[model samples]
Target chain A: MTENDILEAAKQAVVAADEEKAIEVARQAVALGLDPLRVINEGFTPGMRQVGDLFERGTMFLPEVIIASEAMVAAVAILEENLPAEQKEKQAGIAVLGTIEGDVHDIGKGIVATLMRVYGFKVHDLGRDVPLQRFVDEAKSSGAQLVGSSALMTTTMVGQKQLEKLLKEAGIREQVKTMVGGAVVTQYWADKIGADAYAENAQEAVAKALELVEG
Target chain B: MTSYPTRMGDGHAVEMSTDELRCDILAGTEDAADRGRIPALSQEEQDYLLDLFSYPGKIVGVQPGNEVVLTDDGSVNALYGAQSSSGVGVPLSRELAIRVYERAFCMDTMEVGHPDYSFKPVKPIVSLEQQCLESVLSSTIIPIYYGAMPNLALYAKPDGPFGNPADLLPQGKISEARAAQEEAAQALTRDMVYVGRKMAEVGADGFNFDTTASAGDAEFMATLQAVEELAKTTELSIEVGMAAEFVLGMHGQVTYDGVRLAGLYPHEQLKLVEKAGAHLFGPVVNTNTRRSSAWNVSRAVTFVKACSEAASIPIHANVGIGVGGVPMCETPPTSMVTRASVAMVEIARVDGL
Candidate 1:
């Protein structure tokens, strides 16, 4: 009905992880005199912020994350549809995300990617068991603002440090901000490996990304 | 007719080695003559068979499970941990691996109670339990000296990753719960060292550790440290079981409606466990067995992600023909036993046992 109602509806849809509803409400909000930027900035992003918190707390698991991310994508999908041709072509900063080699766990990475998408970050997702060079190469080619890797095991967590080394060896250390996380990854270890930042959870990753961007 | 259905130790004790007894049992089974067997065996059978077989050493790799499955490689896999009857498996053909495990684990551990069980208890549980125990004690067990006494080797998950799970998240709550639960379970087990010491005092030798479904990786290692201490003053050896929790998220605490949790969060706790020096691991997630709630195959496979996370230790996992809770399903005994056996072997292959 009103612009306020439409935005509220869109926010609820994202939190509920209802894609079709998110798209419908997003479109309706735009039609009801809501700013496209406002709907995204105020409505969709906050829902995902909560999703990140839930995931970190383990209150939400994989299926729930998938649902919430779906809604975020749906709203984004609708928003992109209404943008001017030139604006559509405009890209957000790039991010390369992956789980380190020998680690097949990807739940935390998946949440980070979805939240990044909600924030209008262009993400190149490299699924589980990613080799070190693949991360380095993606960062070089994409010129990503952040190169992120997750390793749940302490043994494999060494891959994160390796990625950072590869970045330096490739002479691109300053070009890409390397971020790493997993159960065993502490801020101290981040300093040890020269990772620019570390997110304790998916939400922290987003905040870290923002800080890294601004800094 | 000593009410064959209710006989106890119907056959004479074997003076030969358990391996020889096994051969004799096989011979008797093949004889098609008068057959006698052990009576109804509870899990207590492990101990009964240990004495019956008259072996001096602990058991190792002889297949242990109640359910069996044939892997593509022809090795036997079995359902290990908490079962009505235990199993002892050996390498048979691809086809035989399944058949043998099913017969050993899936079949009734009792003697000829059922009229159709005209087959004697002679080939029943006592022989199987003794064989399983001896195989493990004889080999899978090592005498590691922390002080002056020997602490037996515990569960190892070479496929697991490192770190306590909740550490993977930003939330202190998740890690807190995981940490607390592991602390409690392991503390309980570590204290069992005293009980084990008492058992060894009376010639019990060693007791198995049921470390399944534990919560924290740190707590597990602490428990082991405590047990290692107790062993210095006692004569007991220890065998530990791996839990679904360390590999999967706290078991009943989390599930993926249908998707794989293992695939979703590949880096959790299993690897850190190995760092603590656990050399053996066991897996046979009973989470989805018949009595288990809402859990499914997708949830079970999530543990697979932890499989490659650790290295240089053997791990064991299993499947049941009946699905969910692999514990209750009534399938052929051999398949159940083999399922458990093969899981351990696979862990050995993949984890560098």
Candidate 2:
């Protein structure tokens, strides 16, 4: 198949949530001597975008989006290994994501992390029930441009504010942008907590990360 | 069941399915559109209902229609207590010094929480509940003690047998889940019984196991065990309010009274609630945030209707924000909530909201 045809096939594989097909498309792209980074950006990543659009349009559910993401991740893994050093360096930004301490609900946060990674950000997902100090430490250690915290419960959401305070105390607050999300989290809560962004869902999380990192 | 023209989560117009509302509820789109009209609602009634979305309001109300009984969990706490983060209520009462007890007497029945509203399995909260329970009990309103057995992962590792489910689920640690389910069930049941007895001693009219099975099958089993034990130990009537539409089956092997606990729908859950000796049952139908209120209500009412039909006990459907067809917003729109409430009462035939 021609390069454009192969790329288009890769995109279709992700949309179909066919993980095997995605991996095959990635390997075929590599075998045909196509740029691995281009395959991800031009093919697999756009498919993830379409998945997000379908989700926002209410045509898709969480499980489907999750599977489509998994498919894209598998294909991206194959392509990432083949990318040249110069292309590998062209990440959009580094991000740190987690569910705040005392809140074990992280499905939403996990989705955000996955979508952010698909959007070309190097994400350090801290996992659920993450401590406030951990966010500060990770931001400092990774030099991440964006740090996102999710707290599904109202009792635990206060940890996001404490995280903001901890970042400032650690002297890295100015260097990093902070985003807070979860079921109970709102734009008002984000503003009150002095966060840079508040994404309602994974799709919006990706858009917000781009604005925070590049805009 | 008939198809209803409803908005998806993004406020786009669509027709919710008749038979396939559950799938449509989750995906925020209708898969099967029978396109049958609402025979109960006249064209004018349908137009008025649909216009709730078009003409939005800060706080919407029912059209002075027939009233339905309301039962709340963690209600008063949303006003003057620590739970009231929004700070939109009357002056703080001295009785409400402790943050987590939601003692709303205004409702048909008051649902008061243990002093620690998070319902953590801590000891000090028991004494606090005992101290606060007397003031919350009223002769006019049936007072229920509300609490939850949050997922075991909320408790940290080593101290609790479970690791974070966020990590475990993706990692697929089956044995770890089995071990955690056993240990956490024991811990949660102990706490529920102890607090439940203490509150019963203080004269709570009933017990509401709010958000039970949040950790899936294991947690559901724990709640059932607690309800069984509490029923035997104290005379306090018990009600079990579920956390989600279906049991997550996190611990797929867990069971109550010979029946497997995982993946039970509302109707199935009601049987267990009854078996566990609960007088009332509140079934939760989760709303997709991206789906319109019309879709959510249609979906929520569908599940609730089935559950209610199967229920021998009163079914007080959880029509809250993000569940029971309510919009998934911080402050749910009044129009949508009222619409959902009306539908639950009319279509679902729920005993209470």
Candidate 3:
């Protein structure tokens, strides 16, 4: 079959949330002398990206995002499983993520987590209400090169800057770069707090996080 | 002075000191005594009973009698009064209370937030908290207090949108009466704890601590953790979950755009208080308490389900029912209790209490 035939099938699998079908198509495409990396870049990632967009635009809600992301992760996992040892080394670095203390709302954070996981990063999420100490503690423990702390409240957003301070005190400031986001947190605030990057939504979050970890 | 110098009931006058009555119960005369159905306790049980029940001059304070008082001067047994909510008094079971106190001394729920101490929870607000505690417990069922305070949305940003609409209220003054209103609530918690202790002592089954000032998880839970600690300390065994209204509570949130607000996520954070070991369920914040439909409590129950799923813990949930809808305080007491019991049971109704 032509390359377009395989990519369309992979895209449909996500729309239908048929992870097995998505994986099967991805597996077959790889076996058919196709480029698995191109299948991911051209097929699975684009479909899932659309899912996030639909969600942001209010055309879709959480269950849809969750389902689409699930299908995408499954297909990517299949492609990842058969990746040549040399190629796997080129994947994205890990970034530990979470919402800081007293702010337990997670829709935005969850979307970002799903986006990060489906892409290439190994994510260690600390969930919500994460105190500054826990942020420092998780970053140290995970040995992660990036920490994404998203706050949903201004009062708690202050905790994010406190997180930067704690990380510096722990002597791991240079070990991990940080990204801050949420509606109230702006690039200006990011600069003020000494955070390295800022993003507006889940996709931007993943892009910004990659920049921090890779740079 | 003896509280029961003479028997006023059909039984003839019998002089007895409060301590003597304790002895009779301890001596097992209480086992065969005439009265309504009361859980019979052995000598060991009586001693356990006296340690928590004796009304003398301590914080777990209460004069020894069948009556339960909620007070702060150490006059009667009253922890937030949520646990003793069953009206059966000492709902923790003698075994559970001993178990809880054995491992708990009210300090395990640490003050993890505010390390800078610049934003310490307003205190001797503790005194005010006591007063508000009394206001809520003054009734048998919980009462709802609509918050009158500033939310980032209500007040405008320096140049951002104001209220839900651009002009629902003036720039940064959506609820102008907030400060005065907060002081009133502050006084309520303090005064209520005093009166609530009296109410509990006089046998007002339990108290539900509802407030408008409680906003997010940390704000709500910090207050709740303190309340739970306070409840455990005074032996009042009351249940309190800060009902979250998206707009206001004493936390005095300044962020007008919640969607833009970082750190805050819509999760039922109450279920995660691993140390407080108190029966609770909330961070109920998706819908507006003032504008949402009457069935909003159900959404809160669902939110608890989600948070419980996230934490991998089982939690019971409850939402206030009142005159705003079919279930009013005026309804038969049994009806109100049945609704609350059914909702709680729906979530974590396990075999054991």
Chain A TM-score of each model, in the order shown?
Answer: 0.82, 0.79, 0.86
Query: Candidate 3 on A5-105: residue-level lDDT in tens?
Result: 88888887876667778878988987897878888888887777676565443344334445566778778877876678788666577778888887754
Please write out the lDDT profile of model 2 over residues B1-353, one tens digit for every residue. Answer: 55655544423345655434444343322211111111123334334444543344534454466567777676555565444233345565524522333333445666666434544553456776666667656423355554544445445363454564444434334466467667877877887788788878888788788878766678889889888999888899888888877775555677888987776778888999998888889999877666567656766776777788888999999977678877665466555677788777866778888
Indicate whether candidate 2 or candidate 3 has the larger DockQ.
2
* Highest-scoring model, DockQ: 2
Output the worst ten-in-a-row residue range by lDDT, candidate 2 chain B.
B30-39
Ranking by lDDT: 2, 1, 3
How close to the true structure is residue B141 of candidate 2, measured as C-alpha lDDT?
39
Candidate with better DockQ, 1 vs 2: 2
| TM-score (chain A only) of candidate 2 | 0.79
Question: What lDDT tens digits, residue by residue, belong to model 1 across residues A109-161?
Answer: 76577667656688888877899999988888988988989886656788888
lDDT tens digits, residue span B43-64, model 3: 5534443333233422221123
Best-fitting candidate, scored by lDDT: 2
Please state the CAPRI-style docking class of candidate 1.
incorrect
CAPRI quality band, candidate 3 = incorrect
DockQ of each: 0.01, 0.11, 0.01
Model 3 misplaced stretches (Cα beyond 4 Å)? A89-91, B1-353
Question: Candidate 1 or 2, higher TM-score?
Answer: 2
DockQ-sorted candidate list, best first = 2, 1, 3
